[model samples]
Target: MNALFFISQIIGTVSISAILILALAKLFSRRWRGQAEPARSRGYAVLVTGCDSGFGHHLARSLDLRGFVVFAGCLCPDGDGARSLTLQSSSNLKILKLDVTSDEDVQQAKKTVQENLPEKGLWAVVNNAGISHWAEIEWSTIEDFRSTVDVNLFGCIRTSIAFLPLVRASKGRMVYVSSVFAFFNCLNLGAYSVSKRGLEAFADCLRVEMASFGVKVSIIQPGNFCQATNILKLKTGSDIWEKLDSERRQIFSRQYIELATEYFLSTCRAGCEDAGPVVDAMLHAVTSARPKRRYLLVSAVDRVFFQLFPFLPTVLTDAVFSLSSMYATRTQMLHAK
Candidate 1:
C-alpha cells in the first residue's frame, strides 16, 4: 500500500511539474516570439525545390498567391504537376527544371533566381525535395541507400550551398522539410530515418554557423501525412523480393513480404489526411520575424510520444519495436511452419 501511494504521489508531482513547465514555455514563447506582419510577405522571393508534387508543389502555389515571387523547381518542368501548377498559379510563379541530384541543375537554378530577384534578394529557400523507400536492412540494396540519401540529404546540401549567397544577402531563412522519423528509427524505414537524422544534424550546424550572418535556419519535422503528400504512393516491396538471392528468398518467404508490405502501407495510409498544418508551419518558418528552431507538426498523440522518447528506457523501446517487427513479419510462425 505504501509503495502504491508513493508511486501515485511521484506520478502526480511529475504531471504537475510538466504542466507548469509547458505553461511557462508557452507564456515565454508568445512574449518573445516575433510576429509576422501581413505586409512583410508581399514582394518576397522564395525558392522551393521539388515543386513537381507534394509539399513543394503546394507551398509554391500558396506562396505565389500570398504575393511572394515563387521559383518552383520541378524535376520534370513539363510534367503534369508542373503544367497544372503553371496553369493554376499567377504570373509571379516560375517553374524551373531542378533535379536536386544534379549539380549542373542546381547551378543553373541559382543563376536563374539571381537574374530574376528584386532588390530584396531571395527571401527564403525551402528544401522540400525528398524520397522514401521501405525495406528491411537485409532486403535493401546499396543502390537503395544511395538513391534515398542522394535525394534527401545530399540534395539539400547541394541546394543550400548554391543558394547560400543569395539567402545571406537577404538574411532570409533556410527551411528544410524533415520527418518525425529523425527523432526515432522505425522498421523498414532505416534508410529514410538515417537520411532525415543527417538532415537534422546539418540543419543544426548550419543554424549555429549562420547565426552571425543574420541568416535563420529552421527544420520542419512533420508527422505522417503520407496520404495527403502521396510520398509512398510509388514505393513497393516487389522490387526487394525480386532482387533477393534464392537462399534469402527461402529464408523470408513471399507471404512474409506481402504481410510486411501491407502493414507498412496501411500504417502510412492511416495517418493524417490534411496537410495544411504542415504547410502552415512551413509558411511560419519562412515569414516569421523569429521562427522556431524546429517546428514539430505532429498530432497530440505523436507529440506525447516524442516527449517520452528521451526518457524511455532503451530496452523498453527496443522490445516494443522488436515485437512490432515480429508481428508484421511473423518470422517465428514462418519458421515453425
Candidate 2:
C-alpha cells in the first residue's frame, strides 16, 4: 500500500509541475514575443488569388488602401465582385482574371502581372483560392475528391510555380491560406482536411527550399470562419445524395442526410463572422520583415484543443469522434417517425 501510495503521489506531482511549466511558457511567449520588422508598402506589388469573395476580397482592398500595388486575381474579372472592388479601391488595385486550376489562366495572370510590375518584380503572392464540400467519404464520389484537390492543392502548386520567378527576383513572400483542418481532422470533412494537409506539406517544403533564395513562405491556418467565406456555399448534402445511385443512397438514410445538412449549416452559422483576424495574419505574412513559418488564427478554445490533439491517444480521439457520430445518427433516427 505504501509503495502504491508513493507512486501515485509522484505521478500527481509530476503532472502538476508539467502543467505549471506549460502555463509559464505560454505566458512568456506572449509577453516577450518579438515585433515584426517594419516594411514599406508603397510601390511594393502583391498578387492575391480569389479576390471575388471573402478574405481575399477584404485583403486586396486593405493592401490597396495601404499603398501596395495590389494585383487582385478574380475567377470572373467582369463579375459583380470585381466591379465592386474596382469601385472601392484606387487605380492601384487592378483585377486580373485567374483560374488557378487552369494552366492557361495562370500563365495569362503571370503575363499580366509581369507587364505591370515595377523594376523590383512581385513582392508577394497570396494563394487564397479554395473550395469545400460536406459529406462522408463513403457518400462522396472520386470526382468530389479530385475537384477539391484541383482547387485547393494543385491550384496552389500551379500559382506558386508560375509566379516563383517573379517572387525570387524580388526576394518576396508566398502566403498560403490553409485551414485549421490541416492539423486536426474532423468528421465529414475528409477531402478538405486532406487537401489542407497536402498544402501544409507543400508549404513546408517550399519554405525550406526558398530560404536560400531570400523568398519567405508562410501558411495561415484559420478555424471555422465559413460564414465569412464561400466554404459553406457549395453543394449541399441533399444535392449529393440525389446524384448518388440507389445502392449508395440506401447506405445512408434520408434522416441522416437531413441531420447532417442541418448540423453543417448550424455549425457554419456558429462560426466566426468576422474575417479580420485571418486577413491580418495574411497581411503580416506578406509585409512583416521577419515573418513566421505558420500563423494559426483560431479561438482560444480551438487553439487549446488543437494543441492537445497531437498528444492525445489515438483510441481516445477515435472514441470521441465515434460517439459524436453515433449521437447524431441516433437523434436523427429518433425523429424519423
Candidate 3:
C-alpha cells in the first residue's frame, strides 16, 4: 500500500510540473499583442480580399483608420457592402474588384495594386475570403466539395501567387483566415472542414518557404462565429432532403434528416456571437512586430480541448466522438425506434 501511494504521488507531481511549465512558457512569450506603430504603418499598403463582408470589411476599415493605405478587394466592387465601405472609410481606402477564383481578375488586381504602391511595395495580403458548407459526407455532392475548396483553398493560393512578388519585395506578411475545423473535423461540416485543413497545410508549407525571404506567413483559426459573419445562411432540413435520391432517402429517414439538420443549425446558432477575438488575432498577425505562426481564436475551453486532442489516444478520442454523435441524434434515434 505504501509503495502504491508513493507511485501515485510521483505521478501527480510530474503532471503538475508539466502543466506549470506549459503555462509559464505561454505567459513569458515575447510576442507583442498591441496595435501596430502608427508612424511605421503610415505609408504601408495592405491588400485585403473578401472585403464585401465580415472580417475583410471590418479589417480594411480598421487598417485604413490606422493610416495604412488599404486596398479593399471585393467580388462586387459596386455592391452595397463595398459602396458602404467606400462611403464610410477614408479616401486612402481604394476598392478593387477582385474575384479570387478567376486568374484574369487576380492578375488585374495585382496590376492595380502595383500601379498604386509606394516604393516600399505591398506590406501585406490578407486572404480573408472563404465559404462554408454543411452536409454529411455522403449527402454532400462532389460539386459541394469542389465549390468549397475553390473558394477557401484555391482562392488563397491564387491570391498568394499573384501577390507574392510585391509582398516579397516588402518582406511583408501573408495572413490566411482559416477555421478551427482545420484543427479537428466536426459533424456534417466535412466539405468546409476539408477545405480549411488544406488551407492550414498550405500555410504551414508557405511559412517555412517564406522564412528564407523576410516575408511572414500567419494563419488565424477562428472558432464558431456563424451569427457574427455572413458565412452561413440558415439552410433548412428540406434542402438536404431535396438533394437526396430515392436510394439515399431510403437509407436515411426523413425524420432523421430533419433532426440532424436542426441539430447542426442549432449548434451554429449557439456559437459565439462576437467576432472581436478573431478580428484582434487577424490584426495582430498583420501589424504586430512579432506575430505568432498560428493564432487560435477560440474560447478557453475549446482551446484546451483542441490542444489536448492530439496527445490523447485514438481509441479514447474515437469513443468520445461516438458518444457525442449518439447524444446529438438521440431524438432521431428514438423516433426511428
Task: Let me know the TM-score candidate 1 reaches against the reference structure.
Answer: 0.86
Q: Write the per-residue lDDT of candidate 2 for residues 1-337, one digit (tens) a residue.
A: 9999999999999999999999899757955895455447876799999999999999999999899899999999999999999999999999999999999999999999989986566899999999896677877788889999999999999999999999998888999999888867766788888888999899999998998898899999998899888766555666867877888666677677777777777888898999999999998999887778888888987788777776799887666666676566755675665
Segments in model 2 whose C-alpha atoms lie over 4 Å from true places: 1-39, 234-237, 323-337
In model 1, pairs of residues that clash are: none
Report how far residue 303 has shifted in candidate 3, in Å: 1.6
Against the reference, the lDDT scores of all candidates come to: 0.87, 0.87, 0.87
* Worst window of 10 by summed lDDT in candidate 2: 328-337
Judged by TM-score relative to the true structure, which candidate is superior, 1 or 2? 1
Q: What does the lDDT read for residue 75 in candidate 2?
A: 94
Query: Cα lDDT for residue 132, model 3?
Result: 87
